[model samples]
Structures are given as C-alpha cells and as structure tokens.
Target: MEPSVFTRIVRGELPAAKVYEDEHTIAFMDAGQVNPGHVIVATKRQVETVMELDDELAAAVFRTAARVARAVDRAYQPEGITLLQANKPAGWQTVPHFHIHVLPRHEDDGVTLGWPRKNPTLEELSVLARRIEVKD
Candidate 1:
C-alpha cells in the first residue's frame, strides 16, 4: 500500500515543522496554516477516516491534540481555538489520514463555517440521543 503523506512525514521521508511526537501520534505545523500557530495532530496508524480509528487510536490522537492546543495557547494566545476533524470528501476532508486541525482563532480571521442547523424537537432529540447512547 502507498503510504499516506502523514506516514511519510512520520517516517522523516518528508519535511514538516514537527512540534511533538510520541510512539502513536505526531504534532506538526500545518503546511497551509490557517493561523500563525496552526497545527495538525495525527495518528500514526494511517487510518483513512475517523470511523476507521480504533478506540486506542482515537484516544491517543485526541490526547496529543489537546497537548498541542495547550502549547499553541501558550505560544500564540489567540482569542479562541478550533479543533476540527473532517471525514470523507463530503465532510471536507482533503487528506485521507485521520488527523485533527488545531487552529488558533482571532476576530476577523476570515475563517467561516456554516451548516444548516437541524432544529429538532425535544422528543426527537431525546429519541436520537437514546438511539446513540452506549448501553454497555
């Protein structure tokens, strides 16, 4: 199988402004940074999407992302932070690997996110919530 771009970076085969790395995860400055301290934290397992991630990978990746966000907060001190993870083309995922974008946000940063908020009734929400609840 052809290695994903992230896998190449993890292997030091490509260039990246790496921030932090552990056995299962890596944090690096995004090549196309949205902000001064924009970062990308990714799982080393090379999963194509979030649904492909195992529980361990999910936790590890988030843990690393949180750490990177805190470091960014300390370094950049932006007004807000955005932790974004997209899946599939329909979800705006450009890269195939599972990764999180840790973006530092400021007012008038020119960033915009819009989606039709489906306002559900209380009963509908409760039913949907119950449907997704972990029974175990």
Candidate 2:
C-alpha cells in the first residue's frame, strides 16, 4: 500500500512544520490550520486507526499530544483548547493515519461539532454499557 501523507512527512519525503517527535510519535503543524496553534500528533508506525495501536503506542500518542497542547496553550494562550481524534470516514477521519488534533479555540471560530442526544433512561444506559464493557 502507498504511504499516507503523514508517512511521507515522517520519512522526510514531504515537508511539514514539525513541532515535536519521539521514538513512537511525531507532531507537526496542520497544513489547514483551524486555529493558529492547530497541530497534529501521530504515531510513527503509520497505522490507519487508533484501534490498530497497542496500548503503549496509543498512550505515547496521547502523551505527545498533551505535551504539545501545553506548549500550544503557553504560546498561543487561546481561550480554550480542543483535542480531537477521529477513526474511519464515518467518524470524519480524512487522513487514514491515527493522529490527534490539538486545536486552540476561541469564541466564534466557525468550528462546529454537534450530535443529537439520545437521552436513554438509566436502565437503558446500563444495558447498553454492559454490552460493550471491558472485561479483564
């Protein structure tokens, strides 16, 4: 399979405004910045989704994201911040690579994310939760 855009960036075959990197992850400014401090933190392994990552690699990705978020907060001092991670196309994941978007947010920034609430009852919620609850 061809490498995703992120893979090329990681391999130095493409240009990116890189901000942070480690053995397991790399972070860079997003080409289409929703905000001034918008950045993407991705796994170096080139996995397409978070489900493909083992616990350790997944944790590393979030660790780097948190680190970059702090830096972005300090540098940009936005009114708020958003950490977004999407899965498949249905989940709004345009790029196949697993990554997190650290977005510095402000009022009326034009970004909108909303979903209708189901408002299931307590018993109904419990039943649904039990269906997918993790078991050791």
Candidate 3:
C-alpha cells in the first residue's frame, strides 16, 4: 500500500509546519486551518484508524493532542476549542491515518457539526450497549 499523506509528512517526504513530536506521535499545523490554531496530532505508526492502535500508542497520541491543545489555547486564546477524531470515510475521516484535529473556535467560524438525535430509551440503550461491551 502507498504511504498515507501523514506518513509522508512524518518521514520528511513532504513538508509540514510541525509543532510537536515525541516517540509515538507527531503534531503539525493543519494545511487547511479551520481556525488560526488548527493543528493535527497523529500517531507515528500510521495505523489508519484509532481501532488499529495499541493501548500505549492510543494513549500517547491523545496525550500529545492535549499538550498541543494547551499550547494552542495559550497562543490563540480562542473563545472555545474542539478536539476531533474521526474513523472511516463514513465517519468523516478524509485522511486514512489516525489523527486528531485541534481547532481553536470562535463565535461564528463557519464550521458546523451536527447529527440527528435518536433519543433511544434506557432499555434500548442498554440492549445496544451490551452488544459491544468489553468483558474481562
């Protein structure tokens, strides 16, 4: 398989405005900034989706994201912040690598994310939850 765009960036095959990096993750400014402080924090291992990540790698990526979020807050001082992580194409994941978007939000930034509510009953929710509940 060809390398994902993020893999190319991490390997220095492409250019990115990198902000932070550690052993397991790397962060850089998003090419299409939703806001001034928009950034992307991705796993170094290029696992495509969050479900493919081992616990350690998953934790590392989120840790780096939070760290970057703090930096963005200090730098941009936006009224709000949003950390977004998506999965497959159906879930709005354009890039196939595991990454989180740190967005500095203002009152009317033109970004809108909305979904219809199902409003299932507690019994319905419990039934759905049981299908995927983790068991030790």
Candidate 4:
C-alpha cells in the first residue's frame, strides 16, 4: 500500500507543527483545525488501525493525547473538549494511520459530531456482542 500522509510526516519527509513527542508517539497541530487548538496525536509506528495496535503502543498514544488535551484545556480555555479516534474510512477516518484527535470545543465551533442513532433489540445486541466477544 502507499504511504499515508501521516507516514510521510513521521518519516521527516513532510513538515508538521509538532507539539509533543516521545519514543513511541508524536502530537502535532492539525493543519485543518476545527478550533485553534485542535491537534492530532499519532503513533510512531505505522499501525493502520486501532485493532493493529498492541497494548503498549495504544496506551502510549492515549497517554500523549491525554497530556496534550490537558494542556489545550489550560491554554485555550474552551467550553469543552472532544477526543476522536477513527479506525477506517467507514468510521470517518480519512488517514490510514492510527491517530487521535484532540479538539477544543465551544458552543458554536461549526463542527457537527452527530451520527444517526439506531435502536437495536436486546436479542440483536446480545447476538452481536457474543459474536465479537474476546476470550482469554
């Protein structure tokens, strides 16, 4: 597969306004900020989706995102905050790399995070849950 935009950034081929960095992850200001303080925290490894992340890498990514979110809260003082992560295009993920979006929110930020809600029957939900259940 072709390299993702984020992969290019990680390889030092593309420039980014990076905010935070560690051995396993990097947090950078998003080029398209929904709000001024919107940022993206991405794993250093080129994991394509959340399911591909091992526990350690996943925890590292979230740890960086949490730290960045707290700092954004202090600096921007927005009314609220939003943490978004997408797995596939169907899940609203444009980039193929695994990353987390930290957005500072206000009442009229012009961002709509709504999706159609579905009401499933108990039997339906139970069946689906069992199908995806993880076992030790």
TM for candidate 4 is 0.92
TM-score of 2: 0.97
**Tens-digit lDDT track of model 1 for 37-84:** 999999887888988887888889999999999999999999999999
**Candidate 3 per-residue C-alpha lDDT over 1-136 given as tens digits, one digit per residue, 9 for 90 to 100:** 5799999999999999999999999999999998898999999888989888888998899999999999999999999999999999999999999999999999989989999999999999999998996743
lDDT of each: 0.93, 0.95, 0.94, 0.92
Residue-by-residue lDDT tens digits, candidate 4, 1-136: 7888888898899999999999999999999998999999999888889999888998999999999999999999999999999988999889999999999999987888787889999999999898886743
Sort the predicted structures by lDDT, highest score first.
2, 3, 1, 4
Residue range with the least summed lDDT across 10 consecutive positions in model 2: 127-136
Q: Worst lDDT window (10 residues) for model 1? A: 127-136
Q: What are the runs in model 2 whose C-alpha is more than 4 Å off?
A: none
Clashing pairs in 4: none
Which ranges of candidate 1 are over 4 A from the true structure? 133-136
**What is candidate 2's lDDT per residue for 65-89, written digit by digit as tens?**
9999999999999999999999999
Worst 10 residues of 4 by lDDT: 127-136
Q: Model 4 misses residue 108 by how many Å?
A: 1.6
| TM-score of candidate 1 on Cα atoms, chains taken together | 0.92
